[model samples]
Target: MDPVIDVRNLVKRFRGTRRTAFAPATPDSLALDHVDLAIPEGQIYGLIGANGAGKTTLLKVISTLLLPTSGEVRVLGHDLRTEEAAVRSCLGLVTNSERSFYYRLTGWQNLRYFTGLYGMDRTTLERRARPLVDRLGLSRAMDRDYRTYSTGMQRKLAFIRAFVLETPVLLLDEPTSSLDPLSSEEIRSLIAEECQARDQTVLLSANNLLDVERLAGRVGKMSQGRLTPVESASDLDESLRVARIWLRDPRSRVEATLRTWAGGSPGRPPVRWEVQERNQRTLLRVATEEPERMLPEFLQFLLGSGLAVESVDLRSVDLEEEFLLAAREAEAEASGASP
Candidate 1:
């Protein structure tokens, strides 16, 4: 099946200004490196990245709000450049910024105005938008000027407005940035219902990994303009695990052995490790991107190295940790993107 969103070797760069004619020139900033992505139809695809990591850059390019310096991008099989209008018609985007909505207008008024952009009439707007406003706990404040609403309330309004369009594809950037925990969960539930029952396709970007882990059908980590998509949050978390090997004698050859293994060899995949002596005990924390496939061999190598077997503890990396590892891995490899 063709993907709802397709991006190939996408690159977005910002030109930098020079200080002086005699001074050295600054290179352009690379917001998006070579990125390749394919998001399937009718799925919640979660995108995560650090600040300046290119999450919003990718969304803007796919939404056709910003043009790529080079590379191909298609939305719902529509070329982003040639079919920008059609591609935009297929999307309902909610960006996370307090100023996006009008401060002078009421929440209800803002919703109506946005829906009108899609040619929605008053009756159609009132019918579809009111319930979402109420469902998001904006019923009381919908009639008040948006400037009077708190930041959280405005955020909730921004989320509700997207549904007014009822488009086939949604591009959300921090959909729950300022919401309370209960409200955040409510938005997630709404997203699930919309996607599963209506067959909508959503690409959501957020800083909170736990939210992504819970709501996304598939997960992706974006760093330094490259994206890596995973089948499941479990696939990313489980495949990349953190293991701590404790030693009664921190002075054992375990450190040397693990270091050597971590170093690149002719036939071995180097396992990342950090060694330290903590509280009079030696600690070697090893991280493997493919833990299920590598930990056993790592353990055998440990035993055979004549290291004292004090104890071994297996732990899983959280969403934040998983992103860090994935980001570091991407930067180190600096390879092209993946689906």
Candidate 2:
């Protein structure tokens, strides 16, 4: 299958002014620098990074909201620069900030407004909008004025408006940013279900790792205006040397056991351990390449040291950790430091 979105050496830059008008221009203020990415058709692709990581800038270029300083971008086989109309026809967009809609208009009216812009007929509009209202759990509020709705309700409406076209590609920028947990889950489930059932391609940008990990088929981290495809969540986290270990007991013996195990034996000293208590459990964190081997031995030592092993869990590595590590590494490498 062909790629739904293909970007090569994508670059976007913003010019910043110095305090003095005559100041010389500098080259470090680029927003995106030679970013490359490929998103497959009918797949959920996640764009993750910290603030100022160029995630939104990349999306803007793909959606035609912003022009690239240089590089090539194609959406649904249409060149982003030359075939913008074709790209727009195949795309739907949902943003964190609510777009302007007729406040006095009912939910159905708002959707009808967008459908009309898409040149959908009355019959087709009703047929398409009704199901989306129901699927998004907006049937009850379909007749209510959009202005009277809560933030969550408005967000749901915004999402439905985007889906009104039933476009082949959906571009979501922090779709769940302001939603409550229940509403966020509801929207996430809807995105997943709709994408699978309709064979639609989705490119989602989010700082929430849990949501991205749950929804995306492949994850990419953006930093310093570049995008790097992560092999897996595990690989990203491992590159940062981040892992969580839970201890059954939060006692002196447990702490001592962790120190002893991490400090190594008399011949070779182990790495130092970082310990913290979270909720009812003690967390033991250490930078080590052999967590699997070290954890087992640590557990055995705990048992030998007279500590009960209630539960030992290795917390799953996720996208957030990967993004931070990648961003920091990029910064370090740019500054000529060893990452």
Cα-based TM-score, every candidate: 0.80, 0.75
* Tens digits of lDDT, candidate 1, 104-219: 99887888788888898989988987777777778889889999998778777777777778888989898888777887888788887766776888888988776688878888
Please write out the lDDT profile of model 2 over residues 156-259, one tens digit for every residue.
Answer: 98887777688999999988988889999998988898888878889899977767877888888787777878765545555435455566677455565655
User: Which parts of model 1 have CA positions greater than 4 angstroms off?
Assistant: 21-25, 244-269, 273-285, 289-312, 328-339
Q: Local distance difference test, per candidate?
A: 0.78, 0.76
Give model 2's clash tally.
Answer: 2
Candidate 2 stretches with Cα past 4 Å from truth are 18-28, 233-316, 327-339
Candidate 1, after superposition: displacement of residue 28 in Å? 1.4
> Which ten contiguous residues of candidate 2 have the minimum total lDDT?
263-272
Q: Deviation in angstroms for 281 in model 1?
A: 12
Cα distance off (Å), candidate 1, residue 122: 1.0
